[model samples]
Target: MAKKKSTRRPRARPEAADAPPESANVAQDFANLHVWQIQAFRDILLVAAIVALVWAGYALRAVTVPLLVALLLAYLFEPLIARLSQHPRVSRPTAILGLLGTVGVVVVLLIALTLPTMVRQTTQLVTDLRDERVLARLVELQEAATSQVDRLLGVFSKDETTPDGPETPVTGESDEESAPDGPIPGEPEAGTTGPPVPNGPAVMTEEQVRDLIDERIARERARVAEAEEGGAWWFTPGTGRVARGGWQAISRMIGAVVGIGLMTFLIPFYFFFFSLWYHDVLEFFGRLIPESKRPRTLELLQKMDFVVAGFVRGRIVISLIMGLMLAIGWMICGVPSALVVGLVVGIFCAVPYLGVVGIPLAVGLLVLEQLGLPEAERMGWLWVVLWPTVVFVIVQLIEGWVLTPLIAGKATNLDPVTVLVAVLAGGSVLGIYGMLLAIPLAACGKILLTEVVLPKVNAWTRGEARDPLPLN
Candidate 1:
């Protein structure tokens, strides 16, 4: 009976013909699994990490600035270290130490000489402003010019009788028309005024005019001297007090020293380690990816190196050349502070448009220091206008025709307009530091977008499951 019951087991239920297959079911299950949720969480965590990094950078500028500066120094010197590392007998550490020592010595020497001069010049200028009554004189000159202009305007206004229109001629022997008899001796005859005696020579004699001008100038100078004497209150020791007083100045100096010291100590270390280990670090990271991707990573690194190294090294060479040229030019012109001027010009040349702007300002200031206001007013204008313009034109020519082609070539390849915009944008954001870093950062972004992001986007548009292989 049991056997019969088993044999007569109920017919199995028929599965739905439209049901999804096992593989589809498995995929759907996988989509709902905790593993996928965990992965999503990981992705969110990564994004948050990136955001935190960005926020940290913005929030901690004091810490970030030094690090950024150190990094830049590292980049600048990496190639030298690499070259030294390649030497047969030189150990990497020894080479690094030697390079750092040389750099340090040079920097120390420059600071020792230049800093004292800068401080002395600044202090002297401040003292001169107070003692020479520069502010008062400026105010007096402004007032005198305003007064002279108003007086001239008043005289012109008074001479015009008709307010609304041109002066009408006297047609019927009006009172305005003079009918005086002038036939007496030493007097003009009727209708013989001889064009009003030509106004006693429209031009004054040289000596007369010179004397008048000298008198006016002496008056103006006296006024300026008075004003300057009056404005001497600002420099009075305790007349005006800073909020934190002298302590603030000392604090600022100490802060500057600390900042500079930190940079000095850390920059070489950053440069050395980054130079020695950057390639290996990059290679190690690349190895974490699939073997097929290593070439692409390496290529990106190489391109970045090319852009950064070219900019930094080219700038250094160009700066040196410009400095030498400026020094020679200044010496030829018999300019004082030729070394200082040349150095300033050379340093400013590192900036794009700043060199053009700064050279003139510096020259003008130097000329002012060398010449008094009157002499400066006469000759300083010419020198200031001529030499700076010449220097700028020559520099532009050399940059466009020679240095740019030879050094930068198509490496950075940014358009001039683009570079200017980048500089302005950077200046607006981070000031000088931002301006200094703008080009390299832009280049790096360009490299990243071209090599990393664009290819994936291209593949996705083509419905490809994977990115195309990068060209070496």
Candidate 2:
């Protein structure tokens, strides 16, 4: 064999030689695929790609959220940059830098002015919530509620035919006979600080009330203790382990803050670049679409942009204005944590009536704060309730009549009911971001339904073969 090392290699088996290569067979099969089959495969691939992208976005949200926020800011600020760049002296880059610098300075001023006070108030509020003062107030309120309820029941128990008499709790003779010779069931013990408890037919015994409060307190304390001793890096201060864990936690916290700051700082750069080359980016994406589809696609995107821009930009301005109003109003009314509460309410107000919840929250906080104070220093519940209510009412009136009409306009054009439902649905599915986006998304959906889906459905019903319409 070596002597005659054949110039040619041995041939394959006849069957193997006759058969086409696997790749060629695959190609032939692919070529033979029906049009519908090819379309179906493409659709499946598109769906798979979309699903993969969504999964990746969810998995990487910690990174994606900040980027998305930056993108949103860029989108919001692009028009300003464009307008500024139209001036003879201002180049696009210079416009971006100037605008970003102005925004940065304003933000710094606001933070410097409000952040320390907000932090101090917010910390004090949290501490008050965690302590016994709030719990004691809650108990007193519960007792008062129980007493009122008991009185109401007793009035109903009395004969209706009898003329109205001095209101008194109806303790049946059996209850009085069976009662022990200790202190009355509802009377305050000596040295008690709260309102004198109603003496008569009580709904819940003092022991029962005390036990309920104690149980809740115990559970809360245990939870706080568990959190303090959690498997987190930090632990209660004592040993080397504690020091090491504390350092680790501190370092991690610092790293997180730095990461956030860096991300925030980079947003301006992102905005600058995005604005500078916005047209280039648009053109690049436009090239991907078929020539026939490009105009329609661009039109649809423009419409979406209009809707999103109107809602988002208008809502943000409105929210900021409303928040400022609320903060000032609350501060003027002597509400504790006014800045924090006002800011929260303003943010909530971005979603229409969602801010109504802040009424109860404000009322509760005022009640708690007042109840914690010395009796002489405490504002009556009437004023405590009225101040916040009046502030909210005035702010709402201003917003309904002025700010909304002026700033937000009729961008979404959705009914209040629809807006509420959409917001609730979105919040349930995707938390706060969902709530914020829900209105615009619903509006967009409505447009799609009206412009695209309905027409197709009507055509189908009439047995007409309408060409698949582009979104626009």
Leading candidate by lDDT: 2
Please estimate how well model 2 matches the true structure, expressed as its whole-model Cα lDDT: 0.84
TM-score of each: 0.65, 0.72
* Model 2 C-alpha lDDT per residue in residues 1-472, reported as the tens digit of each score: 4585568878889997798889998999989998758977889889999999999998998777766777788888888888999999989989988988899899999999999999999999989888977888998878777998999988887857566787666679978799777776566776676766776664888789889988998997786688677864244335577678899999999999998788887777677777778889789988999999888778777877888888899888888888889889888877789899999899988887778887888888888877778889988768988999899999999988898788878877788889889998999999987998899899989877777789889987787965566466
lDDT of 1 at 143: 67
Q: Which ranges of candidate 2 are over 4 A from the true structure?
A: 1-31, 34-37, 159-256, 457-472
For residue 331, give model 1's deviation from the true position in Å: 7.5
Clashing residue pairs in candidate 2 (N, C-alpha, C atoms within 3 angstroms): none
> lDDT for each of the candidates?
0.72, 0.84
Q: What's the CA RMSD for each of the models?
A: 10.9, 14.0
Prediction 1 global C-alpha lDDT: 0.72
> Clash totals for all models, in order?
0, 0
Q: Please provide the root mean square deviation of candidate 2 (C-alpha atoms, Å).
A: 14.0
Root-mean-square deviation of candidate 1: 10.9
